[model samples]
Target: MKLLTHNMLTSKCLKGVNVGYPLGIVAKDVKVLETEFNSEFVSRIIPKLDWDTLWNAADSIGHAGDLPRAVCDDYENDVEFLKKVHHVLVEVEVIEGELVCPESGRKFSINKGIPNMLLNEDEL
Candidate 1:
């Protein structure tokens, strides 16, 4: 899964989980499959994301590189910053990993860049 998707995923569906957001990542395999960068798209997406969560997620996986810790005052026209955001948002893929819920400690596995978020019968 991309870090962009990880930023929004939550484990709140599980029983007793209040705010199961910002799931913890245990990445066993990480791949940087570079892709075309679109500054406009990145510009639009930055507003929807939680900056801290994105940075933390990337940092956890050791792919943070030189990504800025905070978004600058002027971002849209900043090509370099946008490029870094685009790289982390789309290029980085978790080929094999597990997402752990912050509240219930439930683990969801990711194989081939797909996260299995389905819960067992009793978990729901």
Candidate 2:
């Protein structure tokens, strides 16, 4: 899944898991493919992204250095920043592995670029 998708995901297995968001990426396989840049999209996405979470996810996949500390501040107007955001949000794809929730330790596995978030009946 793209970091854009990851940005919106949070663990829902339990109600009280404070750190449910920002699921830790444990990718056994990953790919980065280039896409056409669109600054408008990046600028619009800045407010929705979690900087720390995106940074950590990018770091896990070896794409961390390009991102700034804040996506909405100094870098918002910078072309380079928008490029980095495009790369992080569009280029990277997780082919396989588990996204472990920081709080509950629930594992959401990704296969063929699709994340399986379905829970057992007990979990619901």
Q: Model 2 over residues 1-124: C-alpha lDDT tens digits?
A: 9888898898866555765787888998888889999998888888777878888889888887657766555665798879988999889999898888888888999999999888877666
Which candidate leads in TM-score?
1
Candidate 1 accuracy as lDDT: 0.95
Question: How many angstroms is residue 7 displaced in model 1 relative to the true structure, after the best TM-score fit?
Answer: 1.0
Query: Candidate 1 on 18-116: residue-level lDDT in tens?
Result: 999999999999999989999999999999999999999999999899999999989999999999999999999999999999988899999999999
Model 2: ten consecutive residues of lowest lDDT? 68-77
TM-score attained by model 2: 0.89
- CA deviation > 4 Å runs, candidate 2: 15-19, 72-76
